[model samples]
Target: MTATTTGGLPVALLLPGQGSQHPRMATGLYSGEAAEPEFAAAMDEVFTAMGAAGKPLRADWFAERPTVPVDHVTRSQPLIFAVDYALARLVMSRGVRPAALLGHSVGEMAAAVLAGVFTLPDATALVLDRVRRLADAPPGGMLAVAAAPGELEPYLGDDVVVGAVNAPRQTVLAGPEAPLEKTGQALRDALFTCRRVPSLTGFHSPMLEPACRGAEELFASVPVRAPRITIHSAYTAGPLTHGDVANPAYWARHPVAPVLFWPALDALLSTGDHILIETGPGDGLSRLARRHPRVRAGTSKVLPLRATEHGP
Candidate 1:
C-alpha cells in the first residue's frame, strides 16, 4: 500500500530476502536513468558467474510456463541482493535517504551493502561464496509454520529448530529433510498450517554449524569497513558496527541462528515515524511490517519497489 502522508523524512529502508528475486525484475526500472547501469552491471556479473546460458528465470515463468528450480539458495541469494541494491542506489540517486536500514535473512547482506558496511564487489563475492558453502553443506531443509513462537516450542524438542522468526505469529523450522517432513506433519496434525520452503538445505539452524566455522575463517581475511548509515542486525536484533564485521564467525553462525525479525523491526520503528521502503523483487517483508502494531498505528509506512503500481 502507498504510505500515508507522514510529517518527517523517510527514516527506514527495508530489504527483502531470497524468496523475492526474479529474473528481469528490473526491466521497468532499467528504463529509467538512475537504475539502468547498476541493473545491467549486476545482471551481467551474476549471469556470468552462474554460467546460465538461456534467459534468466522471471515471474512470468510461473504464470506463462511450468515452474523451474531457480529458487535454489545459491542463485536466489545474490539475485535478490542485486535487485534491492539497484533499487536502493536508484532511491539514493533521487535524493531519498533513510536514517536506518534492515534486511531479513540474506537481505541483511544487501542492507550491509546499502549502509556502506561493505563494497558491492566484496559483498557480491561474499554472497556467491556463501552460496557455494551452503550448497556443499549437509542435506537439510526449512519449513514455514503459522504458529506463534511459544506455540511452536513443543515441536522444537529434538529434531527441529527454529530458523526464522518472521513475525509474532510466523516461524520457520530447519533440520534434516526427513525431520522437516515429520515436523510439518506434526504441526499439521496439531492444526497449525505449515509449508515447505524451496531450498533443500536447512538454513539458520544448527545444520550450518560446520559452514559457520569456515565462514569465520573466510571473514578473517576479508576486510570489513564501516557502513555509511546504521544497519540493524537480524542475528542480534541490534545495530551492527564495523567491529562486528571482523568476526566472520558471527555471520557464519547467522544462517543457523534464529532470525529475530519482529524485534529488529520493533527497534527500527522506535526511531520515529518512517516511510519503510522495501527494496526488492518481492514484498514479503513489507507485508510483514504492515502487520506490526507500530506500522498499523500510523507510526510507520511500508513500501515495496515492485514494478506494478499496486502497493505492497
Candidate 2:
C-alpha cells in the first residue's frame, strides 16, 4: 500500500452504489479520448442481454424531477459499474493512481477490476449474473434509514436486516417490502427519517442466503487473482487478499451482509490524508466522505469524475 504524506494522508478511490447511476451516464464518454470501444461494446451486449437498450440519465436530473426511477437494482447496478469503470479508465489515462480502492455494494466489482482481481469481462459477467440472481429473488426490497446504526436495531426483526451502514447515521435496511415498510413506519414514528430504495427486491439480508450459495458456486468456477493495488473489502471492513478471492461464497454472501463503511473509511483514513475520488456518475460518495470528521478537517479531498469540456 502507498504510504500517506508527512501529514499521513492517503488517497482513495470511492465507488458509489446503485442509487448513483443515471440514464445516459456513459454517453459523455462515447467519444472521449479515453473511450474504449471494446468496453463500450461489452456494455452494449450486457444491456442487450438485460433487455435494456442504453444507459440511464445522470443522477443530476433527480434534483429537478421527482418521478425519475434511477433505483431499479438491475439498471442501477450495471450502469453504476459501467460509469465507474469509465471514470476509472479516464483517471488512469490521466495518470492518477489511488493508494487504495473501496466500493459500496455492486460498486465493489468495479473496484475489484481496478485492483486487478479480475478482468473487465469476468467482472462484468459476474456482476450481470449477480444482478440476475438478485432480481429473481423473493419479493423483498431495501429501505434507507436516517439514524445512527445502533439506533436502528430496535426496528430489525426476523424478516428485516441491516443491509448497509453507509455512514455515522445512514443505514440501509433490506427485507420483504411489506416488512421494510413496517420498519420504515416504525422509524418514522420514532421521529427518524426513512425512504424506500428503487427496486422492490431485498438485498444484503438473510433473504439472499440462497443467492450467496449460488454465487459461491459460480466463483469457484472462475479464477481469482491478487489485485495490483490495495483493495478494501466492504464485506470484511478491511483489505482483501488473493486468498480471500478464492471464496466465491464471500461474494455470494456479501449482498446479505451489512456494509461496514464507517470502519472501512476509518481504516483508509488511518493510512493518510489524500484525495478521495468518487468514480461514478453522482456525488453521493463524495458527499458521504465530506461528512467524516477527518475529511472535514481537510485531511482528504473528495472529487467526482464527470464529463469534461473535451468529454469524459
Candidate 3:
C-alpha cells in the first residue's frame, strides 16, 4: 500500500559499508524454518544467486568459527552485502516504503540493486568480481581520524589519501600498508586521535586504479536502469541521476572514488524531517546520523534494525 501521506515525516534507509561486520550476526533472523519468511526467502534468493559459493557463504555466515575471518574483503564484502540486502527486504516486507535510501561504499550496491539498477543475478556477478579484484589489490587499509578532512590532508602523502569524509570532524584515510602506517604514526605524533579500520584494503585510494579500470568492461556488460527508489549516493553526495547510473564510467570509477557520505546524508536529511533507519549489520551509520542537528533537536531519529525473531 502507498503511504498515507508524504506530508508526514518520512523514513530513509541507511546502509553501511565496510568496518561494520561481525560473525554470526543477526542469528535470530533464522529463528526457525517458518520464521520471518520474507527475510529467509530473500536470503535464499541472494545466496542462490551466488551460485556454487552459496553453500559456504551461508555456512560461514552462521558458523560459530568461520574458516575465514570476516575481516578479509573476500568474506566481509559479500557477506555484508548479503546481510544488508536481506535486511532491506525485511524492512520493506513490513509494509513500510521508505522515502529514500543512502548507502556507504559497498553498501551502495545493495541500494542500487533494491532500486532496480541491477538485477539479482547481475549484482551477484558484480559483487563476486568486486571481491576478487579487491582481494588481489595491494595490501592496504583505512584509518579513522577524529578530525576534519582538511586537518588530515597535510599528513596524506603520495600513497596515502583521504578515503571518506563521514562527518564534519570524522574522516577516513586509505592507502597501501607502508604509507598508511607511516601516515598514521605522523597523525599520532600530531596528537590526532586516529585508529585503523579493520580488514579493509584501500579500495578508495589511487592504488586501486588498475582494478577500477579493469571493472569498466564488466560494469558495462550488465543491463542498467533508472532506480525505482531514490538512492542518495555517497560517491556523488546526491541522488543518483539516470545519466549517472546508465554510464559505465560512473560504476567503474566507484572503486577509487572518495566517499562523501556526510554531504550525501546532509542532502538526504535537509529536505524535511526523516527518521534515518540503519538497515545494515551494526549501528555505525546510526551513530554518525545521531550527530546531525535534526536528530539532536528531536525532529528526527535514527533507528538501527536488528534481526528479531519476527522481523527486522
Candidate 4:
C-alpha cells in the first residue's frame, strides 16, 4: 500500500455499485472484435471463478439481444462486479496500483474481492447467492433527488427510503416500483428536480428486507479475511475493521441500508490529498467526489477509467 503513494498522493480506487453499470454496458468491451486484451483476460478469470453460472452472464453481456433484461438483479450486480473488477485490473495493468479501495453500494463487495478480503471464488459465491435471493424480491426502482435527505424525510417510509447519500443534496430514494413512482410524482409536484435511477431495485431500504432475511445466513459460510489493501467502508464512514466482519449481519445489511458514500468519501479525503480514480465505466462517483473542497481546491483529483458509460 505504501508503494502506491506517488508524490505524497496515494491512488485510491473507487468501486461503484449497481446504478453505475447499466445493461449491455459490457457488450463491446471484452468480447468479439472490440475485446481489450487485459480487460478480456480479467473478465475471463471472473467467469472461470464463477464456474457454470457465468455462462449466461457472458452470453447476455456479449449477446446482441439478451434473454433477460440486463438490469435484472440476477445479472446486473454480477455484471457490475465483472466490469468493475476488470476495469480495475486494466488500470493496474498500466502499473498504477491503488493504495486503498473504497466501494460504493455493490462496489463494496467488489472492493473486498480486489482487496483480498474475500477470495474471488468466495466473493463470486456471495454475489451469486445475493442475486438468487433477490431474483423474486418485489420489483423496485430508485429516484435521484436534488434535495437533502432531511428535506425529503416526509416522503420516506418503510417502503421508500434513502438509498444513497452521494452529496449534501444529491440523494437517491429507492423502494418498490409503485411506491417509488408515487414518491417520484409527489416530488415532482413539490417542484423538486429529480430523475430516475435505472435498473435499481429497492436498494438501501426495508423493501429488500425479505430477501436480505432469507439469505442472512449466506455470509456465515463465506470466510472473511483482513483486507490486504486498506478499505474504507461506506457503512461506517471510515476504515473497515474486524468488527465489521465479525458476523453475517453486516453483509446482510447491504441491500437494506443506506449507502453513506459521501460520508465515507469525506473521511477518505480528510485523511490527506489522494487521487480518487473511478475504476468503473461511468463518472457518476467522480462527479460527486469532484464536489469536495479538496478536489475543488486542486489538492485532490478524480479520473474515470472508462468513459464508455452507457445511458439509460
Candidate 5:
C-alpha cells in the first residue's frame, strides 16, 4: 500500500501551522459520504484521549462556521492538529506513503506523532499544555513581511524577531503590536507588503520564553522516542537526529525558536526532485514550496490535499 506515486518520485508531506485553519476545514474528509474508516477511527482515538485527559476539545470542527475563530490559539491548535493528522491518515490509507514529513509550528505535533515519536495521548497532553502556556504569554502581534530576512534585519530590535521564514521573500515577524505596526509601516515605506497576521500572541520569539519553559516541564514527563519516518525539523532546518527528537529540551526550543522553513525547504529540495504534498487543510505551505527556486527548476510537483481554493 505504500508504493503509491504520481511519477515514481518519493512524496514529502507538508503540514501547515495555525493561520492556515478555516471553518469546517475537515468537512470533506469526515463527511459521512466521504469519510474514510481510518480517518474516522483516528479522530475517535484523538477525541477519546482528549476526554480521558480531562481537557476535552470543545470546538465543533464540522460546523459550517467554526465556533472557535482562527485567531484563538487554544481551541485552534488542538483542533488543527487533530484534523491534520486525520487527513494525513486518510491520505496514507489511499496508499500515499510519506517519504518525509515537514510541519510548521503547531502542525509539528501531528508530524511528531505520525513519525512515532509520541503516542496520541501524550501528544494531545503536550498540545494542551503548550496551548495553555501560549495563552499565558504577553499579548503581541505578528506581521507577514514580503522582504528578505536581511532586508528586515535593520527593523528588528529586542521586541522584534523573525518568527518564520516561509520562503525567500516571505518572512513573518512577531513582537508587540506597536512594534509590529511600526515595522509594517517601514516595510510599506520601502515598497514591501506587510500584512498583520490574525494572531493575538506572537509565537516563535523571545516572547514565548515563559511558555517554552512550561512546555519543557510538561515534555519532561512525556516519553520521546526515535522517529520511524524522516521528519525535517523547522527548528534545526534539516533532518532531526534521534537525540534531538528524543530530548525534551530540543522540543522545548521550538516555541521560542524561529521557524527556519526556508532553509528546511532548501534542505529537502537538495535531496532530489521530490513530490511535496500539504497533508493538512490550507495550501499555504505548498504555495510557499512552489516559490522555491529548486522546485521551479526541478521536475517536482507540489499538491495540497483538501486545501482552500485561495490562500496566502
Candidate 6:
C-alpha cells in the first residue's frame, strides 16, 4: 500500500466481476502510457502462479483464439481475476493508490489477494478448485431482471434465488435453466426487461452448495493475513473484518452467496469525497457507482481506467 498525500483526492478502486472479461483483455494494458514495469511483472507473477498450478494462463490469454473458450467459467474466472489484479497493480504503480477497494463476485478473490489475505499462488489454487467443482455442477442459468428484489420475490420459489442485487431496480436471478427461462418470460410479460446471462452455472444459489462444500479443504489449506487496506466486500456487502477474511468458512460459502453490490457501493460512497475507479476491462462498476445516491448527492466521482480512449 502507498501512502496518501495530504489533501489528495481519496480514491476507491473497483474490481469487476465475470461479465467484464474479454479475449486478449490484457493486451492493451501493456502498451498504454499508463503501463509500468510493475504491471508487467505482476502479470508474470500471475502467469507463473497459474503455470505452477498446471494451467498456463498466457497460452490461452495471448493466443490468436483461446484454446479453451475465454468465457467458460472454468477458464474465465481465473483469467478475469488475473487481469483485474494486474490492472490494479498497474494503477498503484502509477501512484493512484486507492484508499479503499471493492470487488464483485470472482473479483473478490483478486481483492483478497490485493489486500494481502492470500498469496497469488494460494488465491489461484482456490479459484481453480472452486471452478473445478462447479464444472461438475448440475445445469443452471442466471437472468438479469430489471426490477427490485422485493418486487421479484413472488417469482422466486424453490428453484430460483436472487443472485445479485446490482441496483435498486436491477437484480439477477439464478436457478435451473428450465425454471429460470420460465421466470424470465413472466418478467418480460410483466413489462420488466429480462435477459438471460451467458452462464451455465447458477452461481449464488443453493445449486452451488456442492461446489462450496468441495472448496472447504482448499480454503483451509491457504494461509491468510489481515488486510493492509480497506476492502468493501460484495459477499458481506460492507467492510470486511480481519476475521471475515481469515475465516475459511466465509470463503467457502461465498460462491453460493448473493452479490450485494448495491449496498457495497453505498458503503464506498459514504466515505467522503471518493473517486471510484473501475480498474478492470469494463465500466460496470463505474456505472453502478454513479447510480448510488451519494455520488448523485455530490460526494463522489466515478472513473473508468480501461474504458478511456487515452491511457492514464
lDDT by residue for model 3 (156-261), tens: 8877898999988999999898889999898999999998887568868999887666788998889999999999999999999998898888777777899999
Query: By lDDT, who's the top model here?
Result: 3
**Clash counts for the predictions, in order:** 5, 17, 0, 0, 0, 0
Error of 2 at 225 (Å): 1.2
The TM-score between candidate 6 and the true structure equals: 0.92
Q: Give the TM-score of candidate 3.
A: 0.94
Candidate 5 versus the native: TM-score?
0.91
Q: Compared with the true structure, what per-residue lDDT tens digits does model 2 show for residues 255-303? A: 7887887778777887766778777777778877888877798767766
| TM-score: the better of candidates 1 and 4 | 4
| Better structure of 1 and 5 per lDDT | 5
Q: Rank the candidates by TM-score, best first.
A: 3, 4, 6, 5, 1, 2
lDDT of 4 by residue, 37-149 (tens): 88888888889989998998888886667887777887788988888888888778777768888898889888988888788888888888888878878889989999999
lDDT of 4 at 174: 91
Prediction 3 global C-alpha lDDT: 0.84
Query: TM-score for every candidate vs. truth?
Result: 0.85, 0.84, 0.94, 0.93, 0.91, 0.92
Q: Which is superior by lDDT, 1 or 6?
A: 6
RMSD of each: 4.0, 4.8, 2.2, 2.9, 2.9, 2.5
Estimate every model's Cα lDDT from 0 to 1.
0.72, 0.72, 0.84, 0.83, 0.79, 0.80
TM-score of candidate 2 to 2 decimals: 0.84
lDDT of 1 at 124: 74
Say what the RMSD of model 3 is: 2.2
Q: Candidate 5: which stretches are off by over 4 Å?
A: 1-6, 52-58, 64-67, 307-312
lDDT of 4 at 272: 92
